[model samples]
Target: MIDLQQDDGLWTVTLNNPGKANALTGSMLEELLRIAEAAQEARALILTGAGRVFSAGADIEEARAGLTTSDLWERLSGTIADLPCLTVAALNGTLAGGANGMVLACDLRIAVPAAKIFYPVMKLGFLPQPSDPKRMAALIGPARTKLILMAGQKITAVEAYEFGLVDRVVDPENLLPTARDLVADRLVADPIVASGIARLCQ
Candidate 1:
């Protein structure tokens, strides 16, 4: 489930459903996309999770039903990437599978100091979504990307910060505050000007 809250101009989009560890379902992803589109005028969007795992990636049952999981995931990732204002991901806990795509897509990632960032598709005999590897490579460097995608390394938040996978590693309680600061910092430039520069960076 997706739970949305707005404070000032920052939209906090939290992936709930603690029982599922916030596993993404088709309906949830659809809601996420819709909310993202509607929040384009907001100063920032902060994505987070309600429980110990940020997300377990696409829902297994949804995948088994042959729903367009990959495509839905891509749409979510693309929407996050294309957002005109700053986008931040607050990793309250571990990140795994396709969920990593959203982390890579965000402008900044704030992870709890002990959280693990993992991509285990290799062990499952599944390659990550086509766009994911390239995005990871661009952010954290090609060698690290290989270590992650090819070797299936489980990265800790500290290591991710060192590898440039995440911009900040903070205590769990500090995540939202840190995220807010990140958004505020980005506002140093006007949204129009910032969005223009963001386009060029992309």
Candidate 2:
């Protein structure tokens, strides 16, 4: 389940299947991909979750049905990565499994103090999507990325901030407000100039 809200040039995308910790199904992934592709026109976009967990990654049943290997994961993350606007992953809670890809692709990440970050692809016996490792390494460094992907260590919110995986760790109530604040400047700045600077950083 995906919820997309747009106001002016700002877009907020929420994962709404909290019953399953927002575990993604193939169709849900498709919807996210479509939304991300369309968000090219947004001045700023926020990706968040409706409940305590950002995502548990692929739905268990769907993963058993081959959703884990689907190319849609790559497509969705790549679209977010190449977006000509500021994209922020407003992590409401723990981020795990395949869901790491999209969050890793975002321009910035802010997490709630209760959030934990982990990717256990090794334990799951599946390779992460192609860009995931590189994007993760770019944010937190190769060794730290390995600590999660290889050793399967679950990192705390404060530890993630220290390792540079998350830019800020805030109170749960302030999560969205902080995310909005992070992109506030870009929302009002010249679109071309803002997007240009974002591209230069990549």
Candidate 3:
């Protein structure tokens, strides 16, 4: 499930189902979409996960329960891409599959030193949902994006930073505070100008 909390102008959105590695169910995705869409008053948003992992991506069992993959992808990705405030993904552990789209849609990303990322849709006989490759390329460049999609290689946080996938890498324990601080700093500036700059960069 998704949890939302606000302090000052910062909104923290946490994925909170650690027992299943926070795998996203269809209903969870719907909740996430709703939160992102409704948090218009927030100056910035920081997304993180509970326990040791950020997210293991889509829940395979839930996918087996007749959820429409394409529809879920559209709603979730559209909500993230169009979020009114700046979005940051705080990667605390390994991330894979469709979850990549979540991080890709964020305006900035911060990964813990031990975090890893992989994209294995091809191995699972599915292509990434429409937004995956496109957003990935936009953040890290087409060559690295192709390497990740084509090889299904998992990259460490340092490697990801070097490849331009993440904006920074920090100690795991510092992830949330660091992300919060970044958001706090951003909140001091003019929201309109910040939004414009973010849009222009994207």
RMSD of 2: 0.7
Per-candidate Cα RMSD to the true structure, in Å, reads 1.8, 0.7, 1.5
Candidates by TM-score, descending order: 2, 3, 1
Clashing pairs in 2: none
Q: State which candidate has the highest lDDT.
A: 2
lDDT of 3: 0.84
Better of 2 and 3 by TM-score: 2
Task: Give the count of colliding residue pairs in each prediction.
Answer: 0, 0, 0
lDDT (Cα, tens digit) per residue for candidate 2, span 44-107? 9999999999999999998999999999999999999899889999999999999999999998
Instruction: Write the residue-wise lDDT of candidate 1 on 81-190 in tens digits.
Output: 87887999999998988888877888888899878988877787776777788889998889999898888899999999999999889998899999988888565667
Least accurate 10 contiguous residues by lDDT in model 2: 193-202
Residue 153 C-alpha lDDT in model 2: 100
Point out where model 2 deviates above 4 Å: none
lDDT of 3 by residue, 1-202 (tens): 7899988888899999999998988889888888888878888899999988899888888766745365776667778778768789999888877888878888889998878999887777777888889888887888888888988788889999999999999998889888987877678878888888877975
Error of 2 at 194 (Å): 1.0
TM-score of each: 0.92, 0.98, 0.93
